[model samples]
Target: MWEKGYQTPIYLFNKLIGLQAVVEVVSNHTSNALELLAKQHSQMKTFVYQNQLALDYLLSECCIEIDDYKKTIRRLAAKIKKVAHVPLSKGCR
Candidate 1:
């Protein structure tokens, strides 16, 4: 036998409304988290770009210094060759 008083339409409607409220709350939380993540990703990308530019500048400076060092060495070797009578191929006995 079905209990007529227990299976009311209004009770079922109220339950559905409560479930809808819960779903809305969960959806709002998810949206807020997604927005936060997007902002963090953007900030990370900018930081990486700045670091890359700094690294590139440092590498360029190192290359310029290395070139200057090579030139200086070449000049010194040429002066040594002019002063020494021994040929470099003979390995300075």
Candidate 2:
């Protein structure tokens, strides 16, 4: 499913940093995906700047279409929980 390997995790950490102007969530999301994003946070910041308008538009459009918000949150939370515990034996340490 992940085509880029680890070079670009969630591809949104830097965007998030740009979105909220905060570095706090970096600590919250240290899993594989988030870890990848965190590694290039400096560049992510720049990427966000270059695409803020489009990013904002995309996020806004996405949020507007979620009819079952609670279910979506639960599903996302479950997925995040699962990903957080990925066993080291699956690949690299």
Candidate 3:
């Protein structure tokens, strides 16, 4: 999805990844309920472990992505300011 050439593909990818992580975490927590629900509907069961390490990893990744995006915006803003301040050449009408 990132290679489609949209200017904000990174941001979109990051958001999707973050959403997936959250959904996984939530799905894991509610595994038993879901399994029971599936049983009622004659469907497959699902299981998820309640592990601190996994949650920590997801949280860290989210934090890192947020920081990276912020840094990118700051860099872009600085470059924009530089371009915006450049005076026109004498030859220009």
What Cα-based lDDT does every candidate model obtain? Answer: 0.54, 0.47, 0.46
Model 3 gets an lDDT of 0.46
Estimate TM-scores for all models: 0.55, 0.23, 0.28
Q: If both were scored by lDDT, which would come out higher, candidate 2 or candidate 3? A: 2
Give the poorly placed runs of model 3, Cα more than 4 Å off: 1-7, 32-93
Best by lDDT: 1
lDDT at residue 51 of model 2 (Cα atoms): 75
Clashing pairs in 2: none
- Cα miss at 59, model 2 (Å)? 36
Residues 1-93, model 1: lDDT tens digits:
437755677667667666766666665555555555555666676677667678879776422111123344444544544443223235422
Q: What is the lDDT of candidate 1?
A: 0.54
Give the better candidate number (1 or 2) by lDDT.
1
Is candidate 1 or 3 superior in TM-score? Answer: 1
| Runs off by more than 4 Å, candidate 2 | 1-68, 88-93
- How many residue pairs of model 3 clash at the backbone? 0
Distance from true position, residue 27, model 1, in Å? 0.4
Give the top-scoring candidate (TM-score). 1
